[model samples]
Target: MSEKQYLLDKTLETWKGKRVALAVSSEHSFTGIIEDFDEEVILLRDVVDIAGNKAKALIVKIDDLNWIMLL
Candidate 1:
């Protein structure tokens, strides 16, 4: 598979039943439990420090994300 596809697959594989620290563009950060994911983005809960205060509903696109550190 292509590298991008591989990375996305890895992200999804690592996301299951795990917490992650998502570093996005604009120097924003998000730490939460990954609820679900797709090829383009991820669904996160307990989101904070992005759009506003802490929120349980958030969708972070993969292109906007710089990195994801599995925790």
Candidate 2:
């Protein structure tokens, strides 16, 4: 695996079952408990969004992510 992939895998391991917020773009962000992930996307459960509403789940593309904050 590439170095970036290695680090992403490691970070994913730590993020599992933890509350995290992903910055996708200047206007979009997703916050929730990390449920699962693959090479392409992340599945989040019980997402707490910016508008302060709760969502059952959220799927975010990895390539779209700018940053992730553990909350």
Q: Count the backbone clashes (under 3 Å) in each candidate.
A: 0, 0
- Alpha-carbon TM-score of each model against the true structure: 0.76, 0.92
User: Can you write out model 2's per-residue Cα lDDT over 2-58, one digit (the tens) per residue?
Assistant: 999989989998989999988886678779999999989999999987889999999
Question: Global lDDT of each model?
Answer: 0.81, 0.90
lDDT of 1 by residue, 19-68 (tens): 78888895988888888887888888877765667887679888898888
Instruction: Please list all clashing residue pairs in model 1, or write none if there are none.
Output: none
**lDDT of model number 1:** 0.81
TM-score of 2: 0.92
* Deviation (Å) of 45 in candidate 2: 0.3
Off by over 4 Å in 2: none
Candidate 2: minimum summed lDDT over ten consecutive residues — where?
A: 21-30
Error of 1 at 23 (Å): 1.2
